[model samples]
Target: MATRIDLTLDCADARPLAAFWKTALGYVDEPPPAPFATREEWAAHFDPPEDDPDAADPAGGGAWLCDPDGVGPRLSILRVPEPKRAKNRLHMDIRVPGHGGPAERWERIGAESRRLVAAGGRVVTEFEGHHVVMADPEGNEFCVAAAPA
Candidate 1:
């Protein structure tokens, strides 16, 4: 059987990172688990005397995002005390698929890159005729590729 996997990112703050990723990946905030109708409902019961040790999140302790169509793996952001000190060894490349012709492909890539920039990501460098490297708000590096065949 194929193994299913979830992606976890360690960061300084999870909420904004999760928000940025949600928009970047076209994902939605993952719904709360059973016994809780919504995330807010779950948060409401935080750290009471009888609270379940396994079920507590203090405000923005963490965040989860998932593909709306349930096709992609779950992404969880975990807040850590330390900041990112160096470049990422494993980074994600955002694939912006090409549509029709060469012109159309480049156009689409440019549009997506621009959109990401407006969403708080900044362009780092461009690989001619290929991809553009970008940094998330927290300075994590990732690429916006020219899509896959």
Candidate 2:
């Protein structure tokens, strides 16, 4: 069987970043495990003892997102004390369907770029008819590209 994978991102805050990613990738907040009413309720099952110095906060600061269509990998945004200091070694490319000719493909790419920018992403550079490099609200770099013909 093929293996499935999940992607994780460390951020100063998780909720907003998850929101931006959800907009960029067409993802939705993943629900709590079955039989659990909410994420907090599911987490309560693993709560640490009161005396433990490293006990997790009941109000956690992470967010989990998944593709609504169930084809893409899950995304986990974890809250961390440190901020992003450098460029990401790896990044995601948001691919839009490439139909018609060059002008049409570029139009589709541009449209997606504009949508992402409105959703808290910024354009880094544009490759004209090729692709547009963009950054999330936290400055994590990604790209908006056209899918294969």
Candidate 3:
């Protein structure tokens, strides 16, 4: 059997970036941990005292998203102190299946690219064979590729 895997992204801010990914990938926020009914309640658990920076940002920490139908791997985005200074060593390639032919596949890829751009992702560049390199709002690079037949 194939091993199941989860994905992680390191970024400066987790919430907004995770939100962007959520929209881009049609994923939903993973529910708050057990014993907490909602995200607000979970966040309230870490509410900082007065005069604390955490009071503004909250210490609840990070963001996780998962495929709603449980078909795809989970995605975890964690907060990091430093900015990304170089290209990613590993990156995701968003795969859009080829529907009928090369033309249809390219069209679908274009449509999805536009949707991602509308959701605060930018197409950094395009490449051969229906591939478009894109960057999230935080400038993390990934690609949207037309899946092979």
Candidate 4:
């Protein structure tokens, strides 16, 4: 039988990234999330529909943000206790150039990355090969891998 699952990405600030990816991908975060002033207030009202107080806060589970109308996969930016270890275990690879190659797209992405850095994102590394690895403000490593040169 086939099964479906939500994709979870780990990050330190799920709140901001939720908004970022929303604009970046044309996806939408499900509404502003039912508000609560404190965790205890949240805990009392945010339980799942299954009816269990010992259960988790289903609405705010793991930093979730979703694709608009389920066009793409839902991105769940789960929080992690430690910083990112090495390269991405599952980085997003975008094939740019459409026809030009990695080298060709370098300048374009380079400028974009520069703006991103100026805006506070840090370039973990930019490779001559075909990829540029970067950390967002909250420090998640997603990459912009170009087409082969």
Best by TM-score: 2
Clashes of 3: 0
Clashes of each: 0, 0, 0, 0
**Comparing 3 and 4 by TM-score, which wins?**
3
**Inter-residue clash pairs, candidate 1:** none
TM-score of each: 0.82, 0.89, 0.82, 0.60
lDDT of 3 at 100: 86
Candidate scoring better on TM-score of 2 and 3 = 2
> lDDT tens string, model 2, 90-135?
9999999977899999999999999999999999999999999999
The candidate scoring highest on lDDT is 2
lDDT of the structure predicted as candidate 1: 0.82
lDDT per residue (tens digit) for residues 35-111 in model 4: 86544355466445565433554434345566667756677776555666666666665344535654567776776
Candidate 3: tens digits of C-alpha lDDT, residues 1-149: 99999999988888889889998889999998899987667877874668654455543357889999999999988776678998888888898986688878888888889999999999899875579999999999999988777
Stretches of model 4 off by over 4 angstroms after superposition: 1-5, 31-62, 80-87, 101-103, 118-120, 147-149
Alpha-carbon RMSD, candidate 2: 2.4
lDDT computed for candidate 3: 0.84
What's the true lDDT of residue 139 in model 2? 91
How much RMSD separates candidate 4 from the native structure? Answer: 6.1
Location of the lowest summed lDDT over 10 successive residues in candidate 3: 52-61
